[model samples]
Target: MPRRTLPTAEDQAARFVRQREADRKATAEDYVELIADLLREEGEARAVDLARRMGVSQATVTATVGRLQRDGLVETKPYRGLFLTAAGTALAAEAKARHDLVVRFLIAVGLDAGTAEQDAEGIEHHASDKALTAFARFLSERGDTT
Candidate 1:
């Protein structure tokens, strides 16, 4: 194999930015899952309230709600609460199940909910379906999640 040159700091930063963009795209896929979990846990919620619960600004919640609405995953009305469509609830339930599996795995290895939820949030967005399914199977085999 031929030798390769070491990239300069600037070149490395550019590459890092590109990689970050790719990760953001993957992360955006989690919005649907996030909405599902929030609605499942809280039922109908105002955008402002959800923003408060999720530790985000109302603007951010509004934008995400708009996208979810456009996708038919949620319904929002002026001065009214947000309700998850049936499809949204189903999707969220799946995401929550996967999240529970991951959280259990993390706790099995000795972690807390705050940490587990944080780590699970990052993993849930990017981990493959097959990998999560295998993890769920592992949990079931251990008689934890069934």
Candidate 2:
């Protein structure tokens, strides 16, 4: 058997760049998804509530929300509550779909529901679209519609 070749420096650098980009987007995706959930479940989304659910400080939520507003992903209506822009809503849907797919794939591979959910939180952010498609195909091949 021949020895396997290691990745080139350029390939490694590209991989690292991809990971860094994913890491940066992960927080934004998580926030938008959570806001969407809160809005659907509680009819509103507040920075305090986000902080509590995310285990972060209100100040952190405030800062992040401010950035999101500047990015045109969210809006605030004074006394009302946090609301997602059209772009944000689309993003939240995509994130949720990715997360669900990851969880299902994990479960189909033998992980428990609890562990799959916890692991999917991070895996969904890092998984590429191609990988997600492959997972979906695998599930479909196995007749897993659940």
Candidate 3:
């Protein structure tokens, strides 16, 4: 039998910090991504629509949208739907790319498309750039063009 070594306190703390940061960003990423999708598909993103799509209350959507505005990611016009600032658009594009890459990697590893998509929702948020690059290399090695 081999002896197992536990992580040091510093290592554990760093790991927790990484996870917490990811957790905090997940909601913002999801909102921006959804907003981008809605704008592309329907040409508008309203608080009511976001609430419906997110399965949250309108008040919740309003609160989060306020935070996003303060962060300079979004803007609102009187009687008009929500609009993404340049920063928000860039973030949304990046988030969507990461999500798509994760889904493709999962599928290439033999998971079904539905399962891969569901799993990628969480995995995309937590995966670092290095991890995503490795996944891309693995897919490339496997000759997966799609």
Segments in model 3 whose C-alpha atoms lie over 4 Å from true places: 1-3
In model 1, what lDDT does residue 3 have? 100
Q: Is candidate 2 or candidate 3 better by lDDT?
A: 2
Clashes counted in candidate 2 amount to 0
**lDDT score at residue 122, model 2, on the 0-100 scale:** 93
Clashing pairs in 3: none
Score every model by TM-score. 0.68, 0.95, 0.95
- The global C-alpha lDDT for each of the candidates, from Candidate 1 onward, is 0.71, 0.96, 0.95
- Compose the digit string of candidate 2's lDDT tens values, residues 1-80: 99999899999999999999999899999999999999999999999999999999999999999989998999999999
lDDT digits (tens) for residues 36-108 of candidate 1: 5556676656776667766888899878778778777788766667777887777667767767788887776
Q: Model 2 off-target regions past 4 Å?
A: 1-5
Candidate 1 regions with alpha-carbon error over 4 angstroms: 1-43
lDDT of 3 by residue, 54-139 (tens): 99999999999999999999999989999999999999999999999999999988999999999999999999999999999999
Clashes of each: 0, 0, 0
lDDT (Cα) of model 3: 0.95
